[model samples]
Target: MTRRVLLALLLLGLAAGLVGAAAWAYEAWRDRVLEEGDRRGEARVQARWDEDRARAQEAALDKARQDAAETLRRLNQQQENERAQQALLAQLARDRDAARAAADGLRLRAAAYLDAAGCGHLAGDSALGCVREAAAEIGIALSRSAQIAQRVAADADEARSRGLRCEADYDALTLRLSML
Candidate 1:
């Protein structure tokens, strides 16, 4: 081939190589920009997801707090009911004890009355067997009366110690209970 033709062909080949290199560099730059944009888009989506998760967690926390408050309220109500029941029980017990004490006092008084009707100091008199029997009954009645009086006094003392006073003080505590 001619030298001039060969030189012209070499120049054309160099120009083609330059164009190819330029095209390859352009593609590489475009790919890098696209990768950067994809990374930025992924970061934005992740940030939005994190925000949504935080909001859901906050909502759950709020619900838990509400549930806890409700539980506390229910517990308080139950405790109040228990306290009321205990108070009622204590009052009933006090009433029952007062009634029993009053009954004892009345029984003692009745026995003493029966003895006064016939028995008393004439227990040794054999002329009237009935009178002797009455005297023995009187002795038993007096003893029981003393015991009842002691019990009544103790009950009044106990009531006072508990900060609950009986009417008429310690002496007539059972008498007031009998009226009730």
Candidate 2:
């Protein structure tokens, strides 16, 4: 009976040691699982933040591209307008030069007429001579009138050109404002 009791006591001690070791291993496994779950959660949060930042950058880039395109379009329109204005001014200059040449021709013809009429050689104040002098005076008056009319016409044309230029500038300014 003494030997049997000692064997039973040893068996009980071994069973207790086994139970303790199993509990310790279970606790270690649980701790590792919890730590892995926390790391995964942090990675998900960081990914969301990076995605949000990328989307914001993309939106800003799109807006910048739109603004650049609009600016380029406006510049092209302005350059085209300038070219048209230059062409109109050149044409106006050519027309003015042609008109001046015609006026000069008319002036030369009037001078020739006066020379042919010979009113300056008035011989004795006869009625015929008076008539000739009167006709020459009328021709001189008509030439002076033509010169005055030409000057007035030139001034009117200049004013018209200036007004057209001012109107075009105003239209350009309004167009730019509307685009903005």
Candidate 3:
């Protein structure tokens, strides 16, 4: 009976130890699984955050590129307008000079006609006709010259007005670009 009791006690102790060991192994496995889950969750969250940040950066960069393109287009248009205005101004100046030269030539012709006439001692109808025809020609030349001068003056004034407008537009464009 004593030997049987001792054997029973030893068996009970061994069974308790085995149960404790199994519980410890189960707890350690559970802890490891929870830790792995936490690590996976953290990795997923970090990946999402990185994706969000990259998308935001791409959006910002695209907007910047669009703005730069728009600004370049405006600058190019303004420069083209300025060049056109300058060309127009140059043509107007050339026209003005040509008109001035034509007028000068008409004046010289009128002076020569007046000097060549000998109307002081004219007594016959032929002589009178000659003087009248010369006077008519001189009058026509002077009138034409006056018309050309008036036209030139008007054109110069218009060109000046347009030049001022173009300059104003250029200045405004420059100021707007500077702001960008």
User: Among these predicted structures, which one has the highest TM-score?
Assistant: 3
TM-score between model 3 and native? 0.58
RMSD of 2: 5.7
Supply the global lDDT for candidate 3. 0.77
Which ranges of candidate 1 are over 4 A from the true structure? Answer: 1-11, 119-180
Q: Which candidate is the best by lDDT?
A: 3
Q: How far off is model 3, as Cα RMSD?
A: 7.6
Where is the poorest 10-residue window by lDDT in model 2?
A: 114-123
| Of 1 and 2, the candidate ranking higher by lDDT | 2
* Winner of 2 and 3 under TM-score: 3
Candidate 3 per-residue lDDT over residues 1-180, each given as its tens digit: 889998999999999999999999999999999999999999999999999999999999999998898788777777776776777667776777787777777777765665576433342578676886777677677877778776878677676858776776667567666877
Candidate 2 local accuracy as lDDT? 0.74
- Candidates in order have lDDT scores of 0.67, 0.74, 0.77
Candidate 3, after superposition: displacement of residue 72 in Å? Answer: 2.3
